[model samples]
Target: MSDQVVPAVINLDVPGPVISRHLYGHFAEHLGRCIYGGFYVGEDSEIPNEGGIRLDVVEALRALDIPNLRWPGGCFADEYHWMDGIGPKQDRPSMVNTHWGNVEENNHFGTHEFMALCELLGAEPYISGNVGSGTVREMSDWVEYLTRDGDSPMVRLRKQNGREEPWKIRFWGLGNEAWGCGGNMSAQQYAAEARRFGTYCRDHGGNKLYRIAAGANSADYAWTETLMKQLGELGCAYRPQPFMQALSFHYYTIPGTWQDKGDATVFDTDDYYRTLAKAAYVDELITGHANVMDCYDPGKHVGLVLDEWGTWWNVEPGTNPGFLYQQNTLRDALVASLHFDIFHRHADRLVMANIAQTVNVLQAMILTDPDTKALVLTPTYHVFEMNKGHQDAASLRVDLPAGVPARETLATVSLSASRKDGKVLVSLSNLDAGAPADVELDLRGGALSGVRARILTAGNLQDHNTPGAPDTIAPRAHDQVTATANGLRVHLPAHSFITVEGRLG
Candidate 1:
């Protein structure tokens, strides 16, 4: 750790475009307990709910102001048929979920249920089309059924399915992971198919289509380069109309060995630092991929949608290993804050990012207990709630003075700030959790008088919240920040995230 604090002045005068809300996107897959027991509990649970969807969980997500949620499946999206889960719940057919544990999936939660859920959270629904197994017509019709207002065949079916109004879905993923789970196809093959399918998925609602093409697996820059080259410059005659608005990429951080991944709750200092280092790669991926996109289209029409990202590890003992379920700890919270800062810093190219599954699944926000009817909020949830201000706000760069890295595992400290409604909010995260860092915030040449801070930290990096002890690791008010002449001086704890709120009064 370096004791030398280099004095650098940052002119906060330069304010980037208000942050896009989709930058806080979430994901809900039809895997594990995510759908059946997590979000939906059938119309028969003792817990208060609408159509079996937990009310407590809904309120929790609504408080977080969830911007957008990717629904249906990771791989299941390609195989899911929207018509199956609409109208009468009993009449809906049942299918086996092959990608996730081969569990039986009843048609209870179809298009109507999902749209209704999104409505409850006031979130935008980003549906992934089934380009791998389904035909072009099926894909196009699904779009019509959800977004069409006129009396077309699909629109008529929507009326029959008990919904009179269209959903007005904006973000449409052309396919899931096309290179693998989304039906393996060559770059040229997928690009050609994308051109055909995306063309017919007309925007009946007049909403600009955000058709996202399946991106490469982690670190596969070639896949991104090939897709961008094939799609070519946007607005070209040869290019498909409104050609893919964004490219979807997926990445997960696994501490310890990649094969024998360590447990989320049980980790040592080494594991904690290693995970942060691995998680920081997200920024590198964004920069590398954006560089490739610049070669083809410099206008920055296309967005880099980190559609899937989070920490992955072995499921809790006695739980289904195939379910991809794991515990959320303070370590995961730190991991999420770092990613959120990274996303804000590069908000220009990184338009949206979804943190894997939502509830009771991998890196979830809310966890439920079918046996005890208990609902617990994970540490990651608190981070989301604290940082919600970044949504749709102007981004300002923060200068992180050099200090001893939080841990040996992390190398650099990064920061981002934003202003909304006369309030200047700054988010700071120390990558190295082992060493304390002093940050002198240069408010872009502005004066700071009265300021308050709220911080999220834990007793230990490995600490987590369980049903028995849910509030073990959560956010609390901190007075460590002092009022200075130029700006505020913040002493960030090792391996912690803090948000300082300053009013321009």
Candidate 2:
């Protein structure tokens, strides 16, 4: 393995937008075991639970300081009828989850259950409304039921269902993938529907909704262009449009073709590099959409939300093909670190991003065994935990000197820095599978001391944790980092992710 010294700079004085805590958000759709066996087991089951929500799962996610969670979709939101999921468990109507595995949905874990889960985790709730098959009035009434108080019909219905006070909710999605599973509508057609549906989803009592319009598929600049043009026609310079506050789109990293996404735990060197390259492409996608948004809304009033993103791979053998269950490895952790670094750089326009799922689905943070009911915290979980310090922190500019080794797939190393609460946190990832990187960080504009570091790596790129060996790929204190005269020096191993924290002097 080669150890080449790489030079970089971190300017503490040149700070950018406060990296939103919501950018580290997560998603929970009613697909696969994500809801039933994953987050919610029956209250009577053997697993430790509080009101049918798994306690172990809640405790594990709480460590990440989870900011918000998007619920009931990817494609399931459009087809879901909110009314069918309310009231007592036995009385609730069951429906076929057509988008997922064609499994029967009992509708037991509905609006109240979700809000309770959010409260247990101390996270904000981001609800995605139905617009494909449901009517405008139905969407409006549902919003009132959750947020409105006093003598309204919907509020009275909520009381009948045993909720006395309205729960405060801010983020609301207009729909899921409007171009495909959400409705199969053209961009122009969906834009008109967004205006009508958003008109009725009014602010109730003191709760104001941040309505986010369903945006383009990956790289669909024309779709974003159309939506922005329509929004421009609706408002003037003095007053911003009231219809929607932000726009959202989805992106996922796949190393191969869609039909044959490569295996998650078993892949060759080519597959490994290709995956990092594809993950790096998200930077371009963000810039392209931002360019279209700047044309009409140059003042940057509207926000860009990457609601659904993560790695997608073929399901494991013997598992149901429709479940979308896949293993997480060191490669997956590197991919997540790469994405977060890119997200920090574009904090000006990108307000939020949620991984495709939180548990037991695509690129999940934790995996559960159905029969044993055990939990395995994946490597990706450690990345989130280590980088949590960057949440709401002022982003610091990181610069790389010339002649650093680079490849067509991805750079040899990736980095990001942010300052918060009198501390500076720098995250670095060595993407090269066979080479080590020795980095000398030139901390400019300020002084720093008391450097401490932690690293997450494994014996092999395909190394992952199972229930029996949960700590196979966890984070450990790194003693290789040393304080320098100017700043600090770090030695990153092959295929590893590290975070350095210090007190700003």
Candidate 3:
């Protein structure tokens, strides 16, 4: 391994914004087997499920301390009718999921089931409302049915559905991708619809809704600009409260063209670095959108929510093309670590971010086999578990004095630090395919001791966990970290992600 000392400094006193725990949120869509087989095995099945929800999946995600779960879909949300999913399972109508797979949706995992999932995982629910094929009345009624407690028509309907008390929901999406899948509406057109929809999604009882308007696709800053401008118009003089609280955008890391996104587990060193480089582009996308938002709202009142993100690759061989069941490898884990480092750095304006999916979909954390009832925690899952300490922690400034060395296409090293409850956590990733990094970290502003560390890596970048070998790429306690006179020196392996924890002074 090539020896490259990457000098870095972490200032404990130069703390930035508190990294919102919501930044560690997850998304669950009705795409592919993500809902049916991945998370929800029939209650009668022998998968040891709790009311048709997989207990094993819940247990695995609990380790991540998943803050929020966006539900009903990416494209499915625009076509989903909440009323159809609420009633009895037997009586619920079935519809074809045109957006993904074209499979029949039994509507069993509706509003109640989703809420049950949130409760089991102790995660807040972030519901994406229908906009393309649904009416404003339909969206309003859904909000009331879930959050209104007093005697009202929607509350009566909730009682009829066997639930007396209303469930509390805070985050709500006005639409999905309004520019394309959601409706193919123009940015100007969607902005007008967002204002109308946000007006009716009222704050019922003790629940105050944080409405997020569907935003830019990838680098469509025009959409963000239009929404921000319209939002300001709503709060000018007459209306004190803005129509929407936040704006959302979607971006996925693809190594190649969308039609030919390279295979997840079959790639050379060039492909690996290319994927990392594309993932790194998200920082630029955030900056571009944030600049437009800053011009409109310099106070940073409006939050930017990256609701849909993570890698998108060709489906595994023999799987249905519509089903996005790609294998997660050590490389995927590096992508995640890099994204989190960027997210932590922009915690000031970037309020929340949810991985594209949590299970059986693109960049999933857990993979489940329906036939064998086996669950495998992906390498990316370990990254989430390892970096969970950064959730809601005080963000610390990490400066690479010498600057991270570049590999083939992008920087080979990534670093981020945060403090919480007298403890400081430093997360680092070395994306180099065959070179180790000697990161000399100078801890300033505080004295930290009692260092402990863990690392996630495997023999190969494409190495992934299969049912036969679930723990092939799991994280283990690392011993290559040594305390220095000022701070610590970490030896990071090539294509590995590590987290170091130390008690603060």
Candidate 4:
């Protein structure tokens, strides 16, 4: 293993824009209990719910200020025909959810219910269109039903179904997992179909519809390159015909081996470091994919939307493996912080990101068990809430002393600083999970008085939260600080993430 040397002076004078709401976007799939018991639990259930939605889950998400939510499926979206999910719940058609457990989907939580949930969370809805098993007309009609304000057939159907006013849904996924669940088409085939579907996905002049084409799996730069070139050529020929606003990418970090993914919270130190390294791939993926986009369109017409991302591992023992119900731990929090830092640094190219599922699913923010107090906040959830300062805040440049921490693995350190009100908030995370890092801050021109720190770490690398011991590893205030003459010299713990806030006097 060889170590790559990086520059010590990282003078980031270029102030980047605050991250978008969709950066913290979440996913709601028809997979297993993610929908049935995870989010919607019929109104008749004894549990407290509003219109079948778990009230506790809603409240937890609200606490995190969940920005946007993607619905319907991972593979489920591609095969999903929107019509089956609309109309009166009783009259709505039933379909076999072949992609997830082969269970019968009783078309109860359809367009209206989803939009209602989004309204409840105050999150923007990002809907994935069916491009694999459904027709182009199906995709168009769904869009019309959601965005159209006129008296079209879909709009009339909307009125007949109850929702008279059109919901403001702007993000539209062209397809999902096209290489696999989404028809498993070659790049050329998916590109052609994407164009056809995107053409019919009209703006309706309501809200600016950001049409996102399904991107490649991890390291599949060819998929990105081909799509960008094809889309760019089409745009050149037809000024703005069926334009793409973003390209969606999906990546999950699993340790040990791909076949046998280790538990999220029961991993060794090596697995812990490896997991962080795997999560850091987002930076490389963003850069490589962006380079491809730059080749076709230097102006960056299409944004890189990390629609599906987070840690994935074997399901908790004794639980249904298909449910994807796993523990959330301090390791997850570190992963979240590291990825959030990467997204902020690349805010120019990276527009939106969703951490897999929101609640009761893979890498969820909140988990529940019929309101009997099984709700546990994963470490990932805490990092999101902690880093909200970077939301829509300007990105700052910070210089650090560079030294090799581990052999073979690539290492880098940087901090994104944002000023809100009269306080300067800085989020710092070390990508290296195996080695501790020493950093010196060069805040000469800036004021850094009255600085305090809050850190989220644990005694062991595999420490996690359980329903029995929920608050065992939550973040706590670590306000010990020393204001040096030159700048602040902080010792960062290995595999830990910290956020420091200072009021500029």
Candidate 5:
């Protein structure tokens, strides 16, 4: 260790924004084994399942306290029709998932199944409606069917199907990607369409609708501004509208351009650093979009929804190119940690952020073998489990002395802290591939009580879990934590993400 001393100070007395539980959310689409074989193994399969969902997967997700789950699609949502998947399993309709794989999608899992899965996992369902291919009446009926408790046609159909009670669904997306897949509409057109769709998104009982407008692609701040401007006009005293609660934004970090996403499992240090460099730009994206929203919504009346955010790597060789399946590595864990810290920093406007396709899909938390009972948690999964306590926790002020920023990337040390109840949770990530970091904590107005830490890291930067050896990467007790006279001291390992939790006495 060098004689130089550098400390990262945290002031407990000075608090930041409160971290919303919805920030720790997930997403699932009707692509690949994400549904058919990934999480749902069918009730008749030899694999153990509860209500046709993998029990092992259920337990793993529940353990993370997964708050919200966006379902049906990434691009698939706009093409999804709710009615086709509700009746008898044998009588259900089938359609080709043209957006994803050109494979036939048997309507076995629909509204009922998704809500049931959310129930099993204790996650709120953030359903995306079909705006591109569906009419306003269709979305109106879908919401009414899932939320109505009164005498209505949708309610009658719900009873006829098997579910008697209506499920409480607060979050709804009017469309997916209106700029492209959903429909090649400009922001003004989509915003007007959002108003029409928002009109019939009626609250059935106490379930208030938080209808979201389809948001921008990466760095399309003009789209955000345009949508917010039109939405501001529509939601006026002369023309009061429904709860257009939030505007959605989709961004995926790619090492190279979309044409060449680079390899997932096989990547050199330069590619790894570039991938992280792209991840570092998430803060810029959020700040840029938030700044636009701030102008239209000075009171912050309309929040920003980072509906989809994660990494998109080149598909594994010999796999279906359409199905976004990739391997998770220590680098992925680092990228995810950086995104979490960024979202936490902007928790005020950032209502909910779901990592793309929760299982067997791009940057999935859990991976399942195609024809086996094997279920393994990725390093990203472990990071989520470790940081679950920060949900709904008020952010603690974090002050990092501005240092020499990485020339190719942003800050090397990514950190965020939150206090819930009497507990303080500090998550730190040292992204340097070769250098370990020694950072001191200056927790003002509080003495060190007890700090327990867990870390997710690996020997090789490319290290990941294989079905044969799932424990190759997992959380272990951190031995580098000790109390300091000023606050606390944490010696962080390189390419690692650690969450140190302590009782704020």
Candidate 6:
């Protein structure tokens, strides 16, 4: 009388929402060779650059510990204009990136080379502002040209484009896909242009900007309930609260429609269960856009910027179909491990997410070759380098056993759990490519000496990792999980993803 599918419990003190090392972010647009042959190769190219960027793609995005990046982007940041990318680079002024792949954007990786590639990948940049063809005084002088410090006139044109200190940039993005190509408005004219570019987006000297509006794409939810009711009535009719701490959204994983977005290296198994049924509908599009932002933010206070997700197929065969080049399978690493286990089970209204690109565009995580520099890392970048130990941890609270069968097709698993620093990880994804689960978890309150585990399977499901055939789908060492007195007992293969790692002591 024990068929056993029970043990799905997890408690680790049952907390949640700490999971935000900017939710393991990373997105960088300007399409096609994602920023001039991926990570700009120009300071007199030799392939292993440093000042011209690309020190092996910044040491492979700082070995995926990449906390936050997002920049000049997604729809090319509303036709970007930061003074056409700072000054002298042979007198910069190139434009014409007219919404990706229309070509010609030689501003040579603008804005002091994307804030010096986010300070050589220590990360945290976020940018994205230009409210559709700009001007609320041109995004308030681009926030005084990257957080002013004095001597105005955009900090003397950002120290005559040579940067004289004054760049702390704390996540801006008030415009991007503003209801499509960042300009169709509506949602109350993009919440009155996110309350006039979030009223100056200032707070310089010491950096205090977190403003982020301009969301809604998939599931729309009435454009996130009319931009959370006209940006919460323009934050109490603009007093000292011109708020807008976050509200961006965008879901990708189009398996049927959007002009046949179905190939990325051809498919099978019913198009890999219809692209894991559209990437498990991003947890019902983040619980129906968080039930319409809990009706104009029921104490959720904004925050939900999934900032454009991944997996958008079709565009690799002979490129230039708009330069969204593809190729990153293992079904895009189980649709990026079911959207990072549904963004750590909605880390309390999802704090941040940015995986639409990191290199070579769409579902990318590194893939280059500026004429033979060669590099490759995909399998969704080894499932974000094996779930980077669940970033800022603490999310612990999993429980998924209602007779674990198949959720009507595939999706046999896609759980989440956290509690880092002192351990308790867990991060499954088995998406059944034909049964192999034996998950039985139940690791409540304590108990967890040393469980280990780590996977990222291949053996065809369009397995990838090119650049001279890399580890052809990486991440190895994975013990089938152990310790079980009604506690641990894993197996999860048959199209894998695993994570495990325990400790509690």
Each model's Cα RMSD = 2.2, 1.3, 1.7, 3.3, 1.9, 19.1
Candidate 3 deviant stretches above 4 angstroms:
233-241
Report RMSD for candidate 4.
Answer: 3.3
**Tens-digit lDDT track of model 4 for 73-182:** 78999878888888778898899887666788898998888988898888888899888888888888888888889788989989998888888888899999899889
Full-model lDDT for every candidate: 0.82, 0.93, 0.91, 0.77, 0.86, 0.81
Superposition error at 303 for model 1 (Å): 1.2
Q: Write the per-residue lDDT of candidate 3 for residues 1-505, one digit (tens) a residue.
A: 5778998989987788999999999999999989999888878988788999989999999989999999988899999999899888999999999988889988988888889999999999999999989999999999999999979999998999888988889999998999999999999899889999999999997998999999999999988988888876532242214569999999999989989999999999999999999999999999999988888777788899999999999999999898899999999999999999999989999999999899999999999876777899999999999999999999998888646789755889899999999999999999899998889999988888788999999999999999999999999999999888988999998889999999987
Ranking by lDDT: 2, 3, 5, 1, 6, 4
Compose the digit string of candidate 6's lDDT tens values, residues 360-433.
Answer: 88898888865667888888888898888888888887878666667475556768889877887788877777
By summed lDDT, the worst window of 10 consecutive residues in model 2 runs over 231-240
Instruction: Name every residue pair that clashes in candidate 6.
Output: 135-138, 178-182
Model number with the top lDDT: 2
Task: Give lDDT tens digits, candidate 5, residues 2-85.
Answer: 322347778887778888999888999999879988878888988888778888888999999999999887789888999999
What's the lDDT for residue 415 in model 5?
Answer: 85
Clashing pairs in 3: none
Alpha-carbon TM-score of each model against the true structure: 0.95, 0.98, 0.98, 0.92, 0.97, 0.35
Minimal lDDT window, size 10, model 1: 2-11
**Candidate 1 C-alpha error for residue 330, in Å:** 0.6
Ranking by TM-score: 2, 3, 5, 1, 4, 6
State the lDDT at 92 in candidate 3: 92
* TM-score of candidate 6 against the unseen true structure: 0.35
- For model 5, what is the C-alpha lDDT against the true structure? 0.86
lDDT (Cα, 0-100) at 26 in candidate 2: 96
Q: Residue 194 CA error for candidate 3 (Å)?
A: 0.2
Model 5 clash count equals 0
Writing each residue's lDDT as its tens digit, candidate 2 over 332-357 gives 99999999999999998999999989
Better of 2 and 6 by lDDT: 2
